[model samples]
Target: MGSAVNDFAGEFDKQRFQTVDDACKLVLKHFYMAKVDLKAAYRSVRISKKLPFRSKLAPGIFHKLSQAVRRMMSRRGFTIVAYLDDFFICERTKKRCAQALAVLIALLRKLGFCISWSKVTDPCQKIVFLGVEIDSTTLETRLPISKLTDLKSELAEFLLRKHASKKQLQSLAGKLNWASAVVRGGRVFLRRIINGIMRLKQDWHKLRMPGEILQDIKWWHDFMSTFNGKSFFLAKVPITSVVTDACKSGAGGFYHSDWFYVNWVEDYPFATQLHINELEVFSVALAVKRWAQNWRGKRIIVYCDKAATVSCMIQ
Candidate 1:
């Protein structure tokens, strides 16, 4: 009767009813089988005064939602209707269902509520909500592929928006520089795409640190120079790295990454995860552990995803 989009929408996410099966089952055991649907679902109701931001189309959506509720409620035989779009107090008996539905229709009409039978589900079988399929006998909700498709689009939009502003793109650049070796290698090229952010702050520029930039450029050139042959040899050099860290949550952890010197000669350069803090200790322990009469000349590089972590180790 009253048009209010907010009345229905805010509760859309309230898991007050987790799924169709859960809701139906609760009513069945505690109540009854009378069911009704509002026609025009979303357009059946008008926007409430408190939530009248988009009034142009709110009425249509409210009407639709109301129609759906009315259709189902009117036919379910519920004498009383709580929501024009939602049927209330379903009973356990078929006769009760009809009586209840009738009373509800009379109340609505008396209250100047309009009925649109075309929108209601014929007493035929069932309904579905949040992907669950339901009926008088049982309710089965399935994972909706459409929802995932919608989510994918949402994620894409989020990424676009998240990277749209200067601050956002700067954060993204920071994340990418640390997360991707390839991006780190091509930092200069990637800078152009990210740096054109609108309204960028002067002092807060998203530029790579000078020392880091030099290291990245040198590393990139070095790797590219011998990517095919002797670089492979360099990569195969046996490496032993240690990683350690302390967490604010009162947790400490350490890790070791190793590779045979001979395997470094493979086409792919060797790679391993190392915590910058732990690697320093590992370097000392490994050298001491391997202390022998013969000195094995070997070269290896320790890579850490976090620049701060790497700096902490050196300090």
Candidate 2:
């Protein structure tokens, strides 16, 4: 059953769960939050014996069942998000939180879903959700320390091995990707490893360990070791708009004030022989660097024409 779920029903996850960033934003906007993990979430669902587990239709059937839970909670006054069996509830007050929890548990029980008693956190307490630690009081979010420790342990074991197999390297890259989500400027740190993995041509176990890879691993560990919790503070400054554009001649952008005043029009220098995509990215980078102080500890939207640049910013 587990193998079938992993191989064929895995895509069901994408349909039901919001992005981690979205989930964090929802939690931050509310006051009280609770995270609950459904015990044996998938096992609780009974499949029809008429259909084979490996069939493509089986995933959709399971996904529909999960969707039913989401729909039931939608009418309630609080925010409830579910990724498979894990449900996160966010409400304004302790009273509303307790009410939301009671409603959720009752609905799940009514639907024949078993609850993980130990994992059902108190609604009034600060909780970790979607692998990121969130403090309900301050609305700050950070990569969990325990996750970093586990990653380091896995890397330590891999470092001692003479050679890493393809699967091992892939797993390490995944762990790094997860850590990079909440770490500012972390994806750039991962570029070398991602490029190295893509260039593999030799047998999995026969490939030698690259010195560059080792250096990168060390750097990653040291950076994470010193990490104090990074806060995502609420926006206090009112930003108007930041528009970015690039041309063969130069790259530049202009930011407007919330009052519709033209703060400045920036004409930035650019290197020769750069492609369109590079220039597009450079324009946004320059604008951010120029206004870093003005926008520090504030939320702002960056508008750009290039889809590739926007996608990179999102990742």
Candidate 3:
């Protein structure tokens, strides 16, 4: 059973989805894989009849239910990773996968949770979970074609409009940032759009685009045209931390006792309008580009004072 704090209060105790990096590691080690789905997981939870539909106790009830299911599955020797209703089972052999699936399905039915047979795919060499396609044989992960198509469609529809509100601009930027999780150096593409929106005053509707913004829109189209569903390989790499700082006019970084600086060139279009947050992000990007050859296939941990900049880079 989950504690009261887990059920009712802060998110510190909540279970989060596993990161793609870690999941890919498992796929590389385990050649055989299976996926299980619990139909309407939250809706199927058997709460007390007395609890009202909109009761505050709903989350606590659900937490208890999830905890119970996790405990039951763990004790059965079927080690698995989960995100809400989806469970991923990885094994070294087909026999182990079959055994785990049988145990998992039997346990789910005994617990009274309906299983989605349609979504329960069989063991395969390649499988997709949480929008990421994992190829066990090659030890690689890539965004599925379906997700890429949807993202491209959304951006196309967004650019078609003659005028866009601040809300729409933010939505479009959010979509691009979401894709950055899988796409390396992806957030840089949205710098123009984000800066444009930030420059807007109180007037959020009927936003105007400057010449640079228009140029960026064209650049984005060309960029997407060249995209061929980029794929990333799974590798364990050593991480080097880079600390960066910036002011209105310049930015610098400290890495391995070496310091570097970049003076904001007024002639550059980006430098003139770059906000402090953008400067901080630019500093990190600059550092990465400068050292990428040496750090190829290695993780670079960037520490910046600006929270917004850090968040933007991660997205």
Clashes of each: 55, 0, 0
Candidate 2 per-residue C-alpha lDDT over 120-239 given as tens digits, one digit per residue, 9 for 90 to 100: 877764777767777767777777767778887887776676667666777888888777657666776677777667666432634467877777777777786677646674465557
Model 2 segments more than 4 A misplaced: 1-16, 28-30, 48-64, 153-163, 185-222, 233-240, 257-270, 311-315
Where does candidate 1 have its weakest 10-residue lDDT segment?
Answer: 227-236
| Model 1 stretches with alpha carbons more than 4 Å out | 1-22, 29-84, 129-132, 142-148, 156-315
Ordered by TM-score, highest first, the candidates read: 2, 3, 1
What's the C-alpha lDDT at position 148 in model 1?
Answer: 31
Q: Each candidate: what lDDT? A: 0.40, 0.70, 0.70
Ten residues in a row with the worst lDDT in model 2?
258-267
Give all TM-scores, in the order shown: 0.30, 0.74, 0.63
Q: How many residue pairs clash in model 1?
A: 55
Clashing pairs in 3: none
Q: Candidate 2: global Cα-lDDT? A: 0.70
Q: What local lDDT does model 2 show for residue 231? A: 60
Report the lDDT of model 1 for residue 211: 43
Error of 1 at 206 (Å): 20
Across residues 160-231, which tens digit of lDDT does each residue of candidate 3 receive?
Answer: 666777877877777676565566666667788898787654335557656666665565565666676655
TM-score of 1: 0.30
Better of 1 and 3 by TM-score: 3
lDDT string for model 1 (1-315, tens) is: 654444455533221212232344334322344444444444434446655664434444454545455455546543323332545434566566556666665655554555666543323234433333334443222223454344334334433242244554555445334322211133543444453543354424453334433343344344434332110011223544533333222212223533222121232122124443444444443433544222233333444455665664444
